[model samples]
Target: MDKMQRMEQLVEQLNQYNYHYYTLDQPLVSDKEYDLLYDELTALEAETGITLPDSPTGRVGGELLQGFKPHRHLAPLWSLDKAQNEEQLINWNNRVLRLIADYNSKNPDTPLPDPTYVVELKFDGLTLNLTYTDGKLVQASTRGNGVIGEGILAQVKTIKSVPLTIPFTAGTIEVQGEGIMNLSVLAKYNETAAEPLKNARNAAAGALRNLNPRTTAERKLNAYFYNVGYSDGIRFSSHQEMVAFLKENRFKVNPHVTYHDSFQEVIDVLHTIVDKRSSLDYLIDGAVIKITDMRTREVLGYTDKFPRWAVAFKFEAEETTTVLESVTWNVGRTGKITPLARVEPVELAGVTVQNCTLNNVGDIERKNLKFALGTRVFIRRSNDVIPEILGKVTEEQDGGEIVYPVNCPACGFPLEQRGAHLFCNNRLDCKPQIVSRITHFASRDAMDIETFSEKTAEQLHDELNVREPAELYTLTFEQLIKLERFGEKKANNLLKAIEESKGRDLASFLYALGIPNTGKSTTKVLADHFRDLDKIMNATVEELTELPDIGGIVAESIVSFFADPFMQAGIHKMLSLGVEAKPPQQAAPVTDSFFSGKTVVLTGTLHQLGRDEATARLEALGAKVTGSVSKKTDLVIAGEKAGSKLAKAQELGIPVIEDEDELIKLLNGQNE
Candidate 1:
């Protein structure tokens, strides 16, 4: 067949596979067959020189949006004043007392009201706004820049914990919540995950902001809506009453909350949370204490950005004794050498944490976290956020203090101190740096060359006499099968993943290129501006840094990638394999702000405007149409309920729009 026909067939097959994998959770073909087809299609696309819109190549979407258009917050989401340490927390206690004294002065005859503080676990997850009307859930948004949040109302409903339709009958209420995933699911996800996740908080935060809602759902995420963002026609005089109302409305409110008559009681609860922090399913970084009485809260009101009624009391990180088996170092993309402690497996939080970050040699000195072989050290994983060594030796553990390494642990090169960081200038040749770089190249956000997993990568390097990402394509199906643990099926699947990765849109490839600070978002902007991979490869530092998000480091990385004859050589090999990359066609600058306040939902197959076109248009305007309808949605544009979002939108009272023309007119600054 001609390259065009070949390309066309591959698109049809790959699109179907993507729908099955991404949309249906079922893949039809075996790993090897899919890879061959994917590889063929990528070759055809490169040979024919045409970019497809629905191509899986376009993941992460195009472009880091030129500085987000600011949307006026319905109710300004104020920042909370932080108590970084115990001293600040005590000052907060003193301030709460003064406020109560001032309140008593006005009603001298009445006994001084025993003011109460409600304490709740401060979850280490993404904060969101959920809007409800007449007890139906409508909209959900991220606290993007505090003033305007990304309207992810569609993604929000996919989360089963977030009620699409409220159980209680209330006019209008804004529910505040923390979107989090438990550690059990996190571990399970990491088992099948593209890579081992850093921590639960990063995983949870990444899940909420993900482009695909299906990903959000599969993670088994849940949330606890604690604060009343705003509720109309609801008469809740106290914080306790509001929380009770939330519970009555079938909302998942934090059950740990208790009303305290004094700061001492609040402190007691804080201590209790710190003690119990290691056992909770969800990570609690701190305790959020708020005034219980609404009238008292109003009296305290707010500062320029924070409410005076509430404060977050972050506890000192919980530390426990663990015997350090050894210390290892990892070289990062930024060249910072990070020290890790291999500890005796201990169940500190909900799971057994094995490795703890020592940060750097300076950190070792500062925390006295020095550890020699077999040294007993105080290990702390703060709220299951990140593990750290509290201290190493002396009377504390009767362990020997470890001497910090003065040379690069990997290459044994003399390390130079730059500020707080220690660096190994060996760059890409270093083993950790090479593995990390190659791994990054095959990442989901990057070139997405899935076949090069850690096992396959290790096998290829240590066993198959192969090294680096470029060597991946040269891997024969038989070679993959020959590796230990590699059955015919697993080998075929890995090959398919590699084939599918070829001919990705330039955005993904750039991200995969492992440029410093230049990942998914940065890749899109560069792809559009450069319009070709060769131009980007040849770009000067001055030329690269000109893009919005691409700063000095990123630009330097780009310049370095091309300069590294090694990286350039890899790109050439990839191109020779028909793993071509190209820029997307730039759409016209939109003038209509129709999307300004509208919440739109697109369904079924659109003709005039493809899914990508429709989404981009709506986003350019001021409209905040989400993927699903909740209490906050104004309308739904249904072509056909291709996805689950359509059914949920209908179950709610969202006004459904029919086609692109209707959406266009509505967005063209027209009411009709």
Candidate 2:
């Protein structure tokens, strides 16, 4: 046979081998034999400069793709209501019952049958929506918004388990599933990876979202389809039927789906799943409970956000025990010493965690870990955040004592106890404190000096003697060029960047000051309220506390930060060096605008306008633009690819302006 014919034969053979091995978990051939055949096909394809459409080489990934195009889903990918506890689960069931009762009461002749539930593992990974036409996988996308998603067909094709073609010659269908990196796969990848991934969920999601399909293939992702969201000429009486359909079509459907005739039985199954959660190879954050009967699901219908017949029973954050091997104290920019606990590496939430935060020395004492080093401690990680030590596993104080340092770890300065924290008052002499302060001042949200990094900060502190933010303004190109790795171009670039940072806005300047217990939001509020540096520096704690989101502690921190003689000297020096803390331009008071008195939230990427500009415009119209969505939020302006914030807005029934045109119109006070 010719090369083309042989390539076709090999492609079909390799596809079957992949299906048997990856989907059915049964290898058809030895790895050596498979590789030989694959290599032959690869060589032939390269020789001819042509590859067939169904070639197995596609699974190896192709060239990089341009940015993802928005794929409008045929059917909306609905979010599920969550039940964090048994009480919440029971409440959800009651709501379903009430809805079903009301529906059956209206239709007496053909009343819906009593609800039965289907429980499936809720994989904690990226949501994938795949579209097929004429048995060919045409498109794959992320669950961006319920209505639209970013098309990622090349990334999805890299998954060996995702069938390129199916036996079902349907007109069109959209299948919904989760793309996940198995915990085992993640661990294996980390062994050889230069930069190890932190978590399987993030690894899978980041891979799929990567512009290069080669990166996605490197992750070796697996998918499990659960729901047939859209079908042209297909129907299922129950979710079980849908799963069977997915399985029949060679889609990898998870095998953990269970059916129960009663809600109480479903709850029992959930508890059983929770007990076995740690044993699973993949990450499952919860169990999804859906009404089994499709007709009943139709009768129950959906809320604005989620289906009334379905709820996700979310498991509590994973907790595991590990030995608290030792504790190391580190100094921050504010000179506060934080105790970091080194523990025996343990897997929690698909990540091997060896270090956990103890917050401060007081946290160590309060958690009874003062004498618990070398003993097992309970560490809980929630929402993929850094793990925290809950307490020791046992009441016995048999482990080694955790000694608190009397001096700063970095500078050997005498420490002072303030509240629960230890502080080093050495601002000028401490290397870590100075370096961190310089880094923070040049951070993107602050002065935004391009190419500035922690290493650069360290080099400046050690070599240039640039101990403070104001000192940065004094460095000449001649002095900078003498430093290690500093060429003439590099020195000039650094000087230019420093020159540009002198024009940073007042809010950014305030944040760069690194006030203790204060954040960017508070700084922005201060800049907006005071609009002048001298006014803010002289403002009393009572005046500061009158601002929104400013508590007594924050007020005191601001007041105290300005009160320091060193801080006063720094500000004066910065001003003398021509640093312009330019106040925002004043706008006319807007009391009668549509956004006036409204609590608004902006999320996702705005193609037409920048996020900061949108915020400024909203604020100028008297709108209180917050970072998160809540019941108090009167409106949400969601741009393209809006995620959880948009979902929350929908769940809370807060009105959302999704289109850029509509947002612009609203901003201009024009009628819809």
Candidate 3:
């Protein structure tokens, strides 16, 4: 092949590999192999003076820019309305539905149905508007006030994930996406830096707006396309179609985007994203839910600031800067000495955070944390209820040095240093430790005893001398009534709740036992493997380690916990006091089912069964029910008003069952 042709071929292969590695998480070529091919392309381009616009060589780095020019967006890039909670999200959905209803009322002949929503992750990064002309990248700008923005084409070219050229030659098209710095990239960058970046969002913004493109390239920024601000000679019936078009043109569209017919499903997706936020490689502040139908979005048009058809359901504040007041030590059920930093109350994301976790003495030392009163410290809260200090934000230090406590804050016992963590050995006599253990034992995820707050646990521990979980079952209504905030009715309710907790499942009982490193999921795994408490207690470290997902640390923790005389006595006492731990029921084998080993996606409205019911039924038949329709989907059971998913399934040539009757027949091994 000629030099230009060879470069084009190389670009195509590299782009395909990039898509597989980044988007699909399944790389076809090794990094070393990719690098060798890329180097050859770079050398060929340099020798022949023929550089392909979409070649991977362009992402190496660019010349430093003197200044950024201004670019006006063809169409206004409106912000999304904010929804801090589920109720707010529902209200926004209701308003959009109401608007659609009004439009239907005006035009009765062409009535609009309730619109499906396209939910996407709201990436916490800098927004970039990319404009393409005649299949070539022309302009890239930041979202400056929605109308006009600073041009950053030089810096944008460094993002390897973004396509430098697309296949659209009709006219101009504007695509909006977020430029993000990966958490891993940020950590690597901060290793040798004098002043580290504050957060990923700031790192992205700083990199994108940097005067030096080489610096920006070194940051290794990534982008994910979400919206099309403007398009010419192209038409999309829905947002889903537009996104699919973007993906077809080799844009790095987020794979997490899904189309949901019900608002509850959208909310569920939002919650799921929030729960899995910490596990994600990138930072996302919230989930954006938008009306999928293009016509519906037009009807429920834009307000002054934000689009009426879309809303951002934000999670609790992940990052904020607050003044550090002092540090306090708290004793946990495990007697671990955890440092709690009391900070000046700051509103982050939406919640006010006053106290943040310092984790341990080692963490404080590594972060170079100085608990100087009045100094500003960066606090970050992940999926945890307690926030944690990231680092100091200010230089002015007024407070004294933070001194590690020699003795336990609750009891007079000396703190013992153990592998970067300090622990209090007084597990039996420490008041705070006792209170925490009891409180955790009766927690919702544990024994699930209603009306058993931490304050009530403390009260019971102090007044009634209740030290252990078994003692809780022995408390009488009269004894509870003597305590403060405990009337006759309240006392009766408390006693009844404790009594009702006796039938808690084996997993819950195991978690409630306060075994170190054993969480709810681990407890379930243990319970499923052992089938009973006795089997779990009798299992050796080797056997425990052999269980799925149970490692040496967890296995040793479990075996040691069971071997402890105090723990054994506590379990026996609880069992004697009528705490019946029932083993979880085993699921029936599904190897004989017709739908076994298939992946199914249910979409639209089912008449004969609810969505959850259909999902459960499919799962019971050994079919994995997924939320979105992808190339991996074997079958899609679409019902009435089937929208994006149905269209996608058809486009991908995946088999589809039209109704619940068809699905049921398929499950019965009847060919449709």
**In candidate 3, where is summed lDDT lowest over 10 consecutive residues?**
643-652
Give the TM-scores of the predictions, in the order they appear: 0.44, 0.54, 0.60
> Best-fitting candidate, measured by lDDT?
2
- lDDT string, candidate 3, 259-374, tens digits: 89888898787866765565456788888888898888777888889889888887776787888888898888899999998999988755788888888887666556755656
Better TM-score candidate (1, 3): 3
lDDT of 3 at 73: 98
Candidate RMSDs in order: 23.2, 26.6, 9.4
| Model 3 error, position 148 (Å) | 8.6
Instruction: Give the residue spans of candidate 3 off by over 4 A.
Output: 1-14, 24-124, 131-161, 169-174, 181-197, 210-222, 226-244, 253-322, 345-369, 377-400, 416-421, 442-505, 532-672
Most accurate candidate by TM-score: 3
Worst 10 residues of 1 by lDDT: 60-69
